[model samples]
Target: MQSQHIVNAYDQELRKLHSYIAEMGGQAEQQLREAMQAIVTRDSDLAGKVVREDGLLDELERKVEAQTIRLLALRQPVACDLREVITALKAASNLERIGDFAANVAKRSLALQQMPEIGLTRSLGPLGQTAGEMLNAVVQAYLDDDVDGALRVRDRDEDLDRAYTALFRELLTYMMETPQRITACTHLLFAAKNLERIGDHATNIAEAVCFRIRGSLPEEERQKGDETSFAVVSPGILGDGPTR
Candidate 1:
């Protein structure tokens, strides 16, 4: 009877964590849009809002982590219960990191507001759209426990990475061709870099979904690792060149 009670509590806690993760994910998605909008309109107020919301995401992460740990300890969960606990852990961690990235983008938004406009914002629109879709897909995957859908998102991250690389080259081209555009272009590069990382984290959550379902990582890791070109891009200097 005690074990059964613990199991019920564990299930309840998992439900709570699921809702929390969704809520946090929603905030992050909105933050991404708002950060972009801030850049669009040069709205310091919008940037300030995103920065303030980061704190809420950080606090919610603590809540989710505490509950997940308690479930792990009291339930001695195995099988599905174990998967829930671990997935919640991974999801919470990634979501919190997403919040930080949002704040970073927001910081850039504020900086960009202070600088002259380069009319380069249209280039980022598609990148933001793709990332937003990836975020939505990962959330749905977690909710539906749809491993295939999650895997699809995992695979699609390569597209975002490629888009980012193209954007990096374009920004470099702009900076090299027009010296006056350097400051705004550099800030735009960092903002886009943050958005790219947001997609990567979403993909990380998708991988965690695989881990949750299969109790181990799937073949995607090997396939993703096989790519040799990112190797050419040094990890040094943010691999997109200096943040300056």
Candidate 2:
């Protein structure tokens, strides 16, 4: 039947959209992992590679957007089909942002490498690793279409937020101890914050997966553990304090 043929064609297009999203998710994951490794090892070469690879994510996003537009125009998908298309569009946007954040961490790594060593960098390794782990789990959650898995990923964002807050306090202590460490600490601060944001974006993607599966947003308020904005920092004897 001609109608059956049309239905088959539309299904194929949906599959293509999902394939594109999966590919983009994989790339975003790799970028975060490499960026974190570059920061930990102070490997400028690896950082440069991450910077170069970001363009790939950008291109993939554009492709997803273009394909989604075409599907909307041609298929006029309804209900579940519409939700699948919308989720793909939203997931691509979040993944692209995550890629940008990873690139930022890489750039910060390059900058921090030129500065004097500070003790705070030790905390950064674990912080970045935790963010990467969150990303990996979210990507898997999306692929599995497992709503429970996605909810678990959303919950894990709190862990990264707590790690970031602790790192923020330690970095302030370093800056207060010696004015000479401000420059390096500042760069480390940016890198750690970027990693934290990456975790948030992964959570966003997880929420998208949930919405796609459940056809509604989660009924409960998403748990948030980030305290960077309200964390209190007393003035150091030298007149430097952390305010974020």
Candidate 3:
């Protein structure tokens, strides 16, 4: 009877840990969406709010870390139970990084607000939308423990990379066309890069989900779709470059 009581207590702790992860996942998704909204609307106040919210994410990460350590020390979980705890630790870390990236996008929005609006913002819209969708999908995969769904989510990261590569080329073209646009263009480029990184972190979460389900990480190379190096240039515009 004492052993059964101990087992039930351990199970209860694991369930609480899972619940915390779900809460953190929901907040991460909200942060990504609101960050993109702040950029599209050029709302500094909204952007500031996103930045401030990072503190909550940080606090949540710390909570997950402490809980994980407590479980490792007290429960000494093994096999699948061990994997569940470890994966939760890893997923929380990835989610924390994703939150940081969203805050970075918000910071970039402030810089972009100082300059004239450019057409590159259209490209950002699609890129941010794709990344946000990937994040939502990966979170769902983690929640459902669907290994096939996690694999599919991992594959979708290539779409975000392609969108980011295209946006990079378009922004470079804008900067080269007008020297005065360099400052704003540079900030926008950083913002787009942050969105791309968020997609990468989402892929990381998908991998964590796979680990939780299979007890091992994927052994094969991740299929990548980034093609930034071969960006096409306009005719007779090869000599153009952004001026500092």
Candidate 4:
């Protein structure tokens, strides 16, 4: 009977962790959508909603932190349960950062609305879509402990990088060709840059998930110029990637 009680308690704790991660993931996803929409439509009201919800992200972070402490204190989880807790700790942090990125996008959007438009303004919207979609894959990967799926998430990071680079170059061209648009273009530049960093954070979470599963860091996913001299990285660390 005592053993059964322990099992039930453990299950409940695990469910709580799952619920928190999911809640944060849902919020981040919504932020990305709304932030992009706010910028695209210049809807300050939508921007306001995104700004207001930043607190929710902070709240979720605290909830996850408290839960991790409880798990460490009372449950003393071993093996898979332990791994889940640790992954939850890291994944929640990533989700929180993603939320901030969304808010940053909204803030930039607010500034952008005050300026005249330029051609390159449309670029970050699709990039946000790509990043948000990858995030969905990441949340699922964490839920199911799917390392393969996580690797796929890493793969998409390359596409996001390419998109950002293209957008950056195009915006640079605009600034060079028509110096009058430089002010709006610079703001747009910052927005695109933030979105690009958000994609990096998503990839970072995916890498951490890979690490938690396979017990090693996957450095190969770090791109070519990435000077991290670690073998366990790449798909090998996650047990899947370019080589495998």
Leading candidate by TM-score: 2
Tell me the lDDT of model 1 at 13. 75
Candidate 1 per-residue lDDT, tens place, 7-77, comes to 78777877888899898889878888887777777889999999887888888889888888876777555
Candidates sorted on TM-score, descending: 2, 3, 4, 1
**Displacement of the residue 229 alpha carbon in candidate 1, Å:** 8.6
Model with the higher TM-score, candidate 2 or 4:
2
Please state the error at residue 32 of candidate 4 in Å: 0.6
- Tell me the RMSD of model 2 versus the true structure: 3.4
Query: What is candidate 4's lDDT per residue for 1-244, written digit by digit as tens?
Result: 9888877877787788888998998999999899989988888999989999899989999999998777666565577667667788888998999899889889888888888876567767789888888989898888888888898888888788788776765666666567787888888877887777777877877887888898776767356322222212221233222210
Q: How many clashing pairs per prediction, in order? A: 0, 0, 0, 8
What are the per-residue Cα lDDT tens digits for candidate 2 across 1-244?
A: 9888877877777778878888998898899888888888889999999999999999999999988876776665679877877888888999999999999989988998998666567678787777777777877787788889888888888998898887887787767767787988898889889988988898888888989999998789977788889877755633544342
User: TM-scores, in order shown?
Assistant: 0.87, 0.92, 0.91, 0.87
**Each prediction's RMSD to truth:** 5.1, 3.4, 3.2, 8.9
Question: What are the runs in model 3 whose C-alpha is more than 4 Å off?
Answer: 229-244
TM-score winner between candidates 1 and 2: 2
lDDT (10s digit) by residue, model 3, range 1-244: 9888878877777777877788888888888888888888898998999999988878888898888776666665678877887888888999999999999999988888988887676568887888878887887888789888888878889988888887787687777677798998898889999989988998998999999898888788987877776767663475645332
